[model samples]
Target: MSTSLAEHVDALYSAVERAGPDAFQAALEGIVEATQRSEPAEVSAALERLEPMLARIPLGMGPDLAQVAGAMTDFGGDPASVLATLVERAAGAMEQAARFAELHRAAGLALPDPGDFDAVGETRDRFTAAVQVRGLAGEEEAEDLLQAWYCGDSWVQPVLFMNQRRDVRRALPQRARLLNGVRATREYLGTAGWLEGLLLVLDDEPLIVLDRGFAGTGRGFRVTIGGIGDNFQLHTMLAAALIGHHLPGRAPAPAEVAAATDGPDLTPEGGIRGSWNLVDHGGKWIWNEGRPSDIPHLDGVRVVVLEPEPYQRSWNAGRAYPHMAPLLRIDEPLSPQEAAAWLSRCTTSS
Candidate 1:
């Protein structure tokens, strides 16, 4: 049998540790060549092996590795396969910052002019260097830097959600409370009442509804903020939102409000639903290059189910709504006792 992809990954890391960039390049090329030679089964298995390896590699090598990953995809049947692998497997803020840049490039979106100095990248590098020198105290600075630069621009909000979920789950202090909050939110929002439920969301803070001075009737406008492939992601985000709202000193991590609000499945009926929020009820839906905020106005219900207009650019997947302003403006954290009682009441209510 041919050398397994996992074995090649082992060799690749060995090259990175024992040698340097050149050796890493050579080993990456070898993996690419192996990919080109392998059958579909082998190629699929390779992607599986390559995903977790994203964490083990040097964080600095992300851009280069993403390039090589793109090259590896060239050898595969679909280009998005490798890109999706990197995106699906990225584990941390830094790793996501690097890989998401590649994802943006692969999407064929406009790239910044090469002559322009990447002030953001330079600033991040400076922060990283300082963290190395200053040690623990510098962590706050690094976090701030990551939030300012990476969280919104380079990395998507869902990536941030996944990262936070993984981090909090690892060191989750109060598991019962977290799950209880999730179940309470889910139970309270059972079929309808998301409008009032949303009020309770973010510690009873009300979402600001902006009036654009337009109203009509047609297929409702839906803005997809993040990808939700399964119920687990849905529950994780729901849980994260509760953690941010209910728990004191454990507020949602910086840049996490987007995930907390828009990451989970917006099921007014409660089930394994997708992540599409009604941004426009009867008017033109604005699609800005920046984040999308499309909280539906539940005032009009003529037919109950509105039709959707034929939309182009459906290929834009895995987009995130990070640092969204209107959602962040609402903030009045609920007390833990209130949270517990609310959960208890919701659980015990008819």
Candidate 2:
């Protein structure tokens, strides 16, 4: 709705006299530009203009258009209708699947299911009754919390984005165990709607995008765990951190993460245990008594180990790891010294 965006869109509209490869390229560029400027409304406007031309677009450009639409959805644009048009225009199953994936993720932007809202009531009851629950500020604070729940359920979510040299499917044992642990934790958490993902080449950079819905309340807790060396290590640490943030929980101290790494994996069927297998290393707690030191999920829930070789190749080829756009970002790349320090932290024993 901004005047500048209006002007820009007008320019693009004027330039696209007919539907052709050049027109598709121009529209794609417009969407990308609007997205880069963080103008969601403009992105929507640009896509609206392009949607009518979907039928006329060359079959070869279907994938290209779908790719930009996917990126637009990530950046807050509503491209559902446009994506639907592209999906129908797709020439094959692979093309349809690609377009559908973007459509599915965009669907996540809608309000969460009514059942999901039930958690807010539980949170309210517990929060109201606890006289000394952590961060309790009485009735006003409770109201704020309720309002947050009311605003929407499909808000910010956690995702692990990686660019590496190895396929995620063919992970090293350590990374495999960590991946399994994460999937098991999600299964145990009963978050059925969580997404299982595949490797993708996005924006000319290979990426592994794994994401799912996480409650807003669960995210405000500070991440006390540190000492990360690789994507695998970071993912495992986040699992431990999230577990600690849940009820009857507290964030794992840095020392605990340090201790947990290189430790035995958390295997259920009498398999090898390693860092993925979380233990209470007895670190100090910022909130409650902290996560129980006992091993968890021994029943052995089914887990999906995401092997990320596509991204691994990109990383090994000297490409920087892709940022988790619009949600998480690295303002700058790690320098040699900084990278070495992380490696040192990972290598050093507790």
Best by TM-score: 1
| Residues 1-350, model 2: lDDT tens digits | 53344454555445445554576466566656666776677777766765665546433334455456545555656645454454333212222222222232343322222235566576456544452254334655444433333321111011122212122212312333333423433322222112112122112221111111122121122222222223333333444544443322333444334333533222213321122221111211111111111112211311111121122111111011223211112223334454333333221111
By summed lDDT, the worst window of 10 consecutive residues in model 2 runs over: 311-320
Task: Please provide TM-scores, in order, for all candidate models, with all chains considered together.
Answer: 0.33, 0.31
Clashing pairs for model 1 are: 219-307, 279-294
Residue 221 lDDT (model 2): 24
Question: Considering every candidate listed, which one attains the maximal lDDT?
Answer: 1
Off by over 4 Å in 2: 1-27, 86-235, 242-350
Residue 221 C-alpha lDDT in model 1: 18
Error of 2 at 274 (Å): 5.0
